[model samples]
Target: MYELKEREMIFVFTGPHGAGRKTVAEMSGSTLGIKQVISCTTRPQRPTEVDGQDYHFITAEQFNEAQAKDEFIEVTRVNDYLYGIKNSDIEKIFKSSGSIYLILNRFGAETLQALYGDHVVRIFIYADRDTLEQRMRESGDSEELIATYLSHYEDEMAYREQCEHVFENVDLAHTVFDLTKTLDQYLNRNLLELD
Candidate 1:
């Protein structure tokens, strides 16, 4: 028997590279008026990124401190980098609205769902392999790397079933409209007002 709880939820989204899940999640979070649970990372700051805008861009020492304190909802190593979404960010989002969204890796989504139960709504984003490769090339990665990454898609295909929703990010041109529609449905409202 399953009982539904009405507490605030964590709307998590995951996808393969160049699928635009991160962009869609950010837009959805902004539209919903909740903090998007931006993570802290050990990766170097990119040219367009501020100290904390894109990521916390912390040193290994700082990240280790927070990790030791168990301050993160999920933490993992990805692409030779340390990435973590802090519990404080989750608390911040929940404090403001009836629901919160976290853009996470597939692993994080599963971990959070296990801990939060029905409070976690997972969305898996997908794009055709060719389109994904094209987008990755446009984003400046080498073709070889893009091909290597795309090869993993087949192995990771089963992960999509783990999510509550599977979004196909085909045409990048109309991504906003599609994302907005999904958010509206997920929140069950045309307008989401943040507290």
Candidate 2:
């Protein structure tokens, strides 16, 4: 049986589609030496995405089976696809790292906060609608996909006030720099308290 030596710090990044939450999370994780909590999804993989790297792409049956077994820590349905984080995945990260970041939607982040309490930090990222649309187009998203994402944008943005930190991600470099710096300070302060 494996056990974590210390409580893990969970940073949850939530935002509307094309707001660059995933990109910022990845960059901040790399800069801070923190691992990412990759999620499992039933959605079809994009052309540039890797199966296990970007997401654990599974069949709907597989997702249902996992859910039936109570394997998911947080799960949600979006656009008819299931997305979830597995308990085992967090355990795997905690075996080697003390902190991890998750790219999640508002509901997923809320679930994590309910489970982890103070160990969870919720950060909301956003950009103007025009900027978001431009980003999706530049990333090769289909017009249909862009439309679907934008349709839900306002609803997602409404959750921004519920987050602990909010960032306007107009400039990727600045956002990544500020985010990583903030995370570093937070971790250091928490570690000192633990000591």
Name the best candidate (by lDDT).
Answer: 2
lDDT of 2: 0.89
RMSD of 1: 4.6
lDDT of 1 at 114: 85
TM-score of each: 0.83, 0.92
Best by TM-score: 2
Cα deviation of 60, candidate 1, in Å: 1.2
lDDT of 2 at 149: 97
Q: After superposition, how far is residue 152 of candidate 1 from its true place, in Å?
A: 3.1
Clashes found in each candidate (C-alpha, N, C closer than 3 A): 0, 0
- Candidate 2's displacement at residue 151, Å, is 0.9
Q: Pairing residues by index, what is the TM-score of model 2?
A: 0.92
- For model 2, the run of ten residues with the poorest summed lDDT: 186-195
Which pairs clash in the backbone of model 2? Answer: none
Q: Model 1 over residues 1-195: C-alpha lDDT tens digits?
A: 122247566788887877888787777777666566678999887665777666889999999999999887678787678999887776665665777776667777888888888777888888878888888888887777787678777655579987788878776446756666776765677764334
Model 2 root-mean-square deviation: 4.0
